[model samples]
Target: MLSWPDELTTELRHDLFGWCELWSVPTLADEVTVAVSRRLTSSLGRANYRHQRVTLQHTLLHPMAAALLREVLCHELAHLAAYRLHGTKIRPHGREWKALLIAAQYPPNVTYAAESLPACFAVHKRFRRPPARRSSWARLTQWIAGIPCAVR
Candidate 1:
């Protein structure tokens, strides 16, 4: 039942929008859903391509550093970005993903040392990462902008 502060969600959304703009992709800002979950057992964050959602591990929020959270957020979002640009058949950490990470100003490291955090957060959970089709924050935002201002 852990949840993120509204301000944190705002910041994350802003970052996602910025990345979308950087890539010149179509967007509907509100479409890139962010969910908090305590169910994650091995990863701090995950991106679901089918639903255009990013799930953050709830337990990690309290004890994990903001920088770490930001990094993980960007990492998970990059997966979505890469998927949007490439088909689902592409490799998870393939060239397209690396390119997107570089463009997004992320370190492009496939694996992170989740052990740095305290035991309060289960940083070792194995979350699923899906390959993507063409849908992203940019496209979501653009689509939303065309309609009325919606937040969902």
Candidate 2:
């Protein structure tokens, strides 16, 4: 089972507020519920219910630290922003998610590291061109596979 480090949680809260400032969305408290469950199959994190809540699976928290926390937070918050802006009408990782990610200062491509975890979990070193459309679950499955952790 995975659990968030105290420092990581603190930083995640700060960054979420920062994202709110950038996107012009209302600021949310660190009250975002994060759980590290073994049931998840993707290295990716999820923000469900229109940013009202979020969950970071245990495998997703492999190497914890400040930078890694920020990357994870941004990645999950990107999902929240996408859901909030487009709702169920838009694809989860489509254009809106990519735009919000870049706007939040992360590379457009969903990145993961192979060796020791990256300073930023999902921020790839290589720059990737933004996709034209929302990513389907199939694409997300592929993306998640690229992460070094085992997806249960």
Candidate 3:
């Protein structure tokens, strides 16, 4: 099986592969490429179904708790599972993806609580904003944040 960098343990890999097998996904357990990405910030993980690739924040696995790792890992992997079963035209975190998560026994939350990981906390700090901002600006920010990642 292809190893996920930064020590995503062998057991965890087996579990993920098993999930793929159980779901009968097009992506094989050994065929999926999981890598540690320096570019991932504010996000715990990302999936590119077209490339059959998953890029996780490197820090997320450095001494990370297994539960947190599984949560994030399952979350990202479900995207590929969903795409394999459905199609790319579907929303990134829409019903199809959520259903995959449910079947996989993972919470369907799209965003993770990064404060749990030290490295992710550092990334969060880099993007932290002041406590106060203009109301209009805050409203605009909320509106923009609501836009889908695939569209952005």
Candidate 4:
């Protein structure tokens, strides 16, 4: 886990404000916190917290190239922007995310290259159900072990 540089945070905040301006929405408060942690075992990053309340968390465990970080930041910021504008009606990673992604200057269809981690791997499947809440920890452990995990 690595802390985002101050300059990078400033740039992202500035770009977010610019996006708000473009959409005619109020500028978001500058209180959002970006945290990186090794605890995350899913994808490269995740955005947590919304509803114009607290600092958003962006957790990145494995190494992310600079380009990947850009996408992740924009992707997370889009969630913040979407919640501010459309509340809970907006689908995550759907149209709203895509629009805000582009507005934040990432390519609309940006795809991160699979990061190489000797200790990590991915599962590929369709119709995989969400893990039962009670078994989440076990599931996560399985994932961390490089197993191809699916909830169901």
Candidate 5:
């Protein structure tokens, strides 16, 4: 079974609280939950609005991925935030989520740029941006499902 590092969990909770405060949803902080998943092969993180939980891919725990960890976590958390604020009717990455990302100072991009990521971050294989790239049809399906264009 996979588990989260105690220190990292604590830090993430602190960040979660900070985000809630920033978004003026302090009570939502306590309602939020975090989990780590080794089974997440393609995505970096996921948010379940109905459950108020954020699950992170274990790779974000890697030392080299430190810089991206917060961004990805907040990205998922923003989904929860949007849902908490707007109900289930909003688009996953639509204006509301994009506004939250902007408020958090992250680009509203759906996926991280391969060239800008750390080399060991597994941009190609894990994010599904193979050297040759995937078929346009594949990209469209993933996008329609709210998956990142490059990451599942």
Candidate 6:
């Protein structure tokens, strides 16, 4: 029972270890590491079996998204679980992985619904266009016409 980092709540740790135990791979917990990635904008989570690490999107850390966070965590953990149990020959989202997710009580869906994401983690809102800066050509034309440059 290694103490996980602050990002992993006690409940999450319990679920993670419990899954590993259920799969008869109790030592898997020690082999895996979980991390939060602010750079992960396009995806909710990623699992790297080669490195035995799971990287979750930073937004999932928000308390408002706790349920989603757990699901994504379980999703990634299932990847690791399948790899450990089945080796490299299995498809990434094949029956084995789906079964693991089902066994863990999560839907075996390959991807989450975008609308289900918390608004704070919306991609469009996070990277909003910076006030539509006037191009240099627009500014030059406005200067020649003695007109004030307005951002469009």
The best candidate in terms of lDDT:
6
Candidate 5 error regions (>4 Å): 1-9, 111-152
Write candidate 2's Cα lDDT for 1-152 as tens digits: 12344534555666677886786665433434555444543434556553355555453444423354466667666666666667756655567877987898877574333222212233222222224364434333344444443221
1-152 per-residue lDDT for model 1 (tens digits): 22334646567667777876776554624457667665663445677778777777653355324665666566666667777777676766667867877887766655432232211212222223212452333322232233221111
RMSD of 3: 9.8
What ranges in model 6 sit over 4 Å off? 1-3, 111-152
* Total clashing pairs for each candidate: 17, 2, 0, 0, 0, 0
Give per-residue lDDT, candidate 5, residue 93.
75
Candidate 3, residues 11-125: lDDT per residue as tens digits? 8887888788777874556667888765565455667666777777654554524565576677777777877788777776778877877788765654422222222212234
lDDT of 6 at 88: 64
Q: For each candidate in the order shown, give its overall lDDT on alpha carbons.
A: 0.54, 0.52, 0.60, 0.46, 0.63, 0.65
TM-score of 1: 0.64
Model 6, span 1-152: residue lDDT tens:
45366876889988889988887778988788888876665455678777788887765676656887788788788878888899867877678978998898876765322332221112333233222376533422332233111101
Model 6, residue pairs in steric clash:
none
Ranked by TM-score, top first: 6, 5, 3, 1, 2, 4
Worst 10 residues of 2 by lDDT: 114-123
The segments of candidate 4 whose C-alpha lies over 4 angstroms from its true place after superposition are: 1-26, 50-64, 110-152
Q: Note the residue pairs that clash in candidate 4.
A: none
Give the residue spans of candidate 3 off by over 4 A. 1-3, 111-152
TM-score of each: 0.64, 0.57, 0.67, 0.52, 0.69, 0.70
Q: Check candidate 3 and list the clashing pairs.
A: none
Ranking by lDDT: 6, 5, 3, 1, 2, 4
Q: List the residue pairs that clash in candidate 5.
A: none
